[model samples]
Target: MAKAKVTDEQIIQVGSELQKADKNVTGHALCKVLGGRPDRLIEVWEKHLLESNSDENSLQYIQLSAGLEELFQSMSNDILKSIKSVLATCEQNILTQADKHVENEKVACAERVSALREQLNDANDIINQNQDQIDSLLKENQIINNKYQKTIELEKSVVELSTKLEGYTTAIKDKERIITEQAARIESINAA
Candidate 1:
């Protein structure tokens, strides 16, 4: 009764009903009951069924084909669902890996920043130490310069003292010569 192919089973069932009613049926009657053309091959097929034995092989082939079609449809649906599930899982894994990679990069960046900060701190410490050393060197140089200046002033004093000592020695020699001349004149007059 379904609106699709005219299956032989429906024809056979109608013929059986006609037989039970003790009424003789023909191909035209069967086609009329099935709401098809009485001159169609479907009517001839029904007539063949009434005359000869049914083609069991063809019937089996049709049944098997229908079963295979149903099975193939079911398998296709199952495969599509499985493929969708696998694709979703793959997408989730990709997202998770991306998140982990991002976190790792962040951690690496933080570590690098920490290392750079430490290096900067160390550099600052070195700079401060160098500054202290420079200051100490400058103080030492200033002290040395003061000592050199004092030594230069002492050398000038020594030069002036040496010049005065030479003048005093020349004056003492002149006085000694005059005393010797006076003693000689006194002895000569007494002798005269």
Candidate 2:
């Protein structure tokens, strides 16, 4: 027959002996711990510790006369309040730093906007200067074009005046020929 598994009571008795002998209680994590169900085995060691410490454990001996109990409660409350105050201070410091950071960002943004406006003004000034130069160049070009048109008209008038002079010269030569012929005829008649 398979030997029956060792009981939790038996294991507890061994653990107690080991404790009394000042030896390590369970050499390992209860993997080979004798006998009990696995779940019970785990709690068995804890039960041994409680059983051994029963008399010495303060929480088990609970005869608090109201006064000491109130003092302990007051002490815990004060500690909690102090902890909350420290947390609040830390939170306030974080908020202050965040506000300062936001202000710095706003100032930096304003400076950037001012710089961009200055650049825009500079660009506008350059554009106006270029436009003024363009207008002056256009006026000069108009003056040159007008002078060229007037020169062309003057050349046309000179050509028409030369044509009229040619016609007058031809008529004068014909009149001079007629007068010379009449003079010759009159001289011949007188001679006759």
Candidate 3:
């Protein structure tokens, strides 16, 4: 028995029913309704949808197929071969453009990485140098503190010595006063 040709409206109805299905209406489910294998129907449906929405570059096959009927009816073998070669060249050009874009992105990434590494190295070197300077300043401050402590001790000693010298001078003056009093008393007794 010959198979009946399915209509576009039927296909659309099956797709719509699948979309609104309460249960997971898988591609397999839609295929079963179409009386075709699930995988095959799903592939056809997806291809149809893609072709309808695809950009000019991605729709190359669909565009070519539209002209294929005319080309086959009127064109010679050489002309068909030339058209295929031109399509192949277009595909190659797209691939080359994609490769150049990837290469440019990679170079930019490498350059940015190298620059960041250099900046990090510079920052580390600056930190090291500043740490060294800080250490030197600390050492100098410690030395100055030691000298100030020694000077304070020396001043204390000088103050103590001055106090002792004042006591000795007071003692010498009292002894001289006693000696002068005894000499005056002897002279008075002799005159009497």
Query: Mind giving the per-residue lDDT tens digits that candidate 3 earns over 46-148?
Result: 7666766776556545545557767765676778889999999999999999999999999999999999999999999999999999999999999999999
Q: Please give the distance, in angstroms, between residue 122's alpha carbon in candidate 2 and its true position after superposition.
A: 1.1
Considering only N, C-alpha and C atoms within 3 Å, which residue pairs clash in candidate 3? Answer: none
Error in Å for residue 2 of model 2: 24
Cα lDDT, model 3, residue 32: 74
Instruction: Write candidate 1's Cα lDDT for 1-192 as tens digits.
Output: 556456667777877787789977776777778866555534655576656655655564564478888997899999999999999999999999999999999999999999999999999999999999999999999999999999999999888888888887878787777877888888998999
Off by over 4 Å in 2: 1-72, 169-192
lDDT of 2 by residue, 1-192 (tens): 765376667777777676787877653534354644556565777887787688578676787779998998899899999999999999999999999999999999999999999999999999999999999999999999999999999999888888878878888888878888888888998899
lDDT of each: 0.81, 0.81, 0.78
TM-score of every candidate: 0.52, 0.51, 0.47
Question: Which ten contiguous residues of candidate 2 have the minimum total lDDT?
Answer: 27-36
Winning candidate number (TM-score)? 1
lDDT, candidate 2, at 161:
82
- The reply for model 3, stretches above 4 Å from the true place, is 1-91, 179-192
Question: CA shift at 131, candidate 3, in angstroms?
Answer: 1.1
